[model samples]
Target: MRQALRQLAGRVWWYPHDEDPDNIQGGVAVISDPAGSVVVDAGNSPSTARRIQAAIEAAGLPAARRLIYTHHHWDHVWGACAWPEVEIIGHRAGARILEVEAQRSWSHHYLRAEVEANPRLGPSFRGRAWAMPSWEGFTVVPPHTEFDDDLTLPGGVEVRHVGGQHAEDSTVVAVPDAGVLLLGDCFYSPPLHLRQAGDGYAADLVDRLMSEYPEGRYDWFVDSHSPPRSRQSLRDLIVSG
Candidate 1:
C-alpha cells in the first residue's frame, strides 16, 4: 500500500498505519526543519521504511538525519537498518531490549519456532510474519544513542520516556514549537496478544504524562495506530476510561 504523509502541524508530518497482507506497519512521524528531518519511528520492515522515505521525498521534505524509536516493539523498530545513515535514538531500556533482539535470528523458521514455544507471543505479529513474502534484510537495529529520562534535540524536539502498560520503554515525542505530540503507542492498552490482565493502562504513567505535558500544551496528539486527535480528546479517552 502506498501511504501518503499528512501534515499535522507546520513542521510535523505523519502517515497512518497500514495493514498490509504481510506486515501490520505502525504509523510514522517526520519532524522537518532546516537542519534535517527526524523520523519518529521506523516501520515494520525495510519495504515499509522505504515507503516512508518515499513519502518524505515526494513531499520534498529534508532527508531524515535521525530516527527516534518510541519503544522496542518489532513493528516499530524493525526498519531501522533501512536508514543506515540516520542516527537512531531511543530510551536506555529500549536500547537494551533491542540489543537482545539483535542477537536473535529473525528467519521465518526461527520466528515460527519461537511462536510455537511461546503461545503468549503476539498472535497478530506471528500471523503477519507467516504471511510475509520474505524476511530478507530483516534485522533488529539497536539505537545508536540512548537516553535515560528525556532528551531535547535541535529545533525543540523533546523526547521523554513515559513507560506505560503497552511497553516499559514507551516514549513520547513533542514538538513544542509546532504544538504537536507524536505519541508512539504509549497511550495504547497492553498488546491483546499477551492476554494481559487489568485495564491495560498504568494510571500513574498516564497521570505523569498529563502532568508533564498536559492538555492545551499540544494542539494535536498523534498515536501510532490512531488518527490525530485534540489534546483534550486524548486526555478524556485515557483519563475518563
Candidate 2:
C-alpha cells in the first residue's frame, strides 16, 4: 500500500510501490503534455490504481487520456477497468491474452485464496489495510487499440512491441522528449526464463538504443516492479541477461 511518486524528467513522473516480497504491486509512469497525459501500466488493483490517479491529480496533470499496457499480466492489465474512459493500448497479442484472462474466473479465485493462505501477506493484503480485489463480478476492459509493431503518440511518446524475455507481447515505451523509457518488467527483473521472446530480440532493442544514443538519450528506464533505472543500468541488465 505504500507508494511514492517522483519526477524523473520534465513532465514525466514515476510512482513506485515500496518493494514488498509477499505482495507486490506494479509501478507506473506518467507522461504529460499540454494536450493530455499518458499513463503507463496501471497498478495491480483498484486501490493502487486510485492512488495512482490521485498522484496524477496532485501533480497537476490532466486525467489520463490514454493508458499503455506493457503486457497482459494481471498486475498490469486488471486496473484498466479503473480508468474506463481512457483509451487503452497494447500489443495485439496482449489484447488477446486479456480476453482470455477475463474468462479465467477460477484463476482469480485461486490467487485470492493463495494470498489468504500466506501469512506473509497479512499486514498488506489480508489485514485491514488492503485486501485482494474481489473477483466476484470481475470483468476486464480490454485495450481499445492494438498494434503489431510500433506506434507514436502525440508528444513523441513511442510504444514499440519490443518482445523480451518477459512475455511475447512485451512493450517498450519511450518518451523521447523527456528522455525516459518504460520497460514493463521485460528485461529488468529476471528469472530470464520467463521471457517468451528470445533474449536476442531484447538485446537487439538495447543495442539499437545504445548505438543511437551514445551519450545516454534516456535518463530513466523504468520497470513495472522497480524504480527508475539509469541508461547504463538497463544496458548492464540487457548484457547480463
Best by TM-score: 1
- Candidate 2's C-alpha runs over 4 A off are 106-108, 112-133, 188-205, 212-214, 236-241
| Error of model 2, residue 147, in angstroms | 0.5
Pairs in clash, predicted candidate 1: none
Task: Provide C-alpha RMSD values for all models, in order.
Answer: 2.2, 4.9
| TM-score of candidate 2 versus the correct structure, residues matched by position | 0.81
Best by lDDT: 1
Backbone N/Cα/C clashes per model: 0, 2
Encode model 2's per-residue lDDT on 1-241: one tens digit a residue: 6555678898788888557655666788888877778999877776677789988888788789999998887677666777867889999998888888777543445556756787554433332123344654346767899999999988788998877666789898888878777878765433332323443435776676556544557677777776677877877877676
- After superposition on all CA atoms, how large is the RMSD of candidate 2? 4.9
- Our tally of clashes for model 1 stands at 0
What lDDT tens digits, residue by residue, belong to model 1 across residues 72-98?
988888888889999999999999889
Model 1 TM-score?
A: 0.91
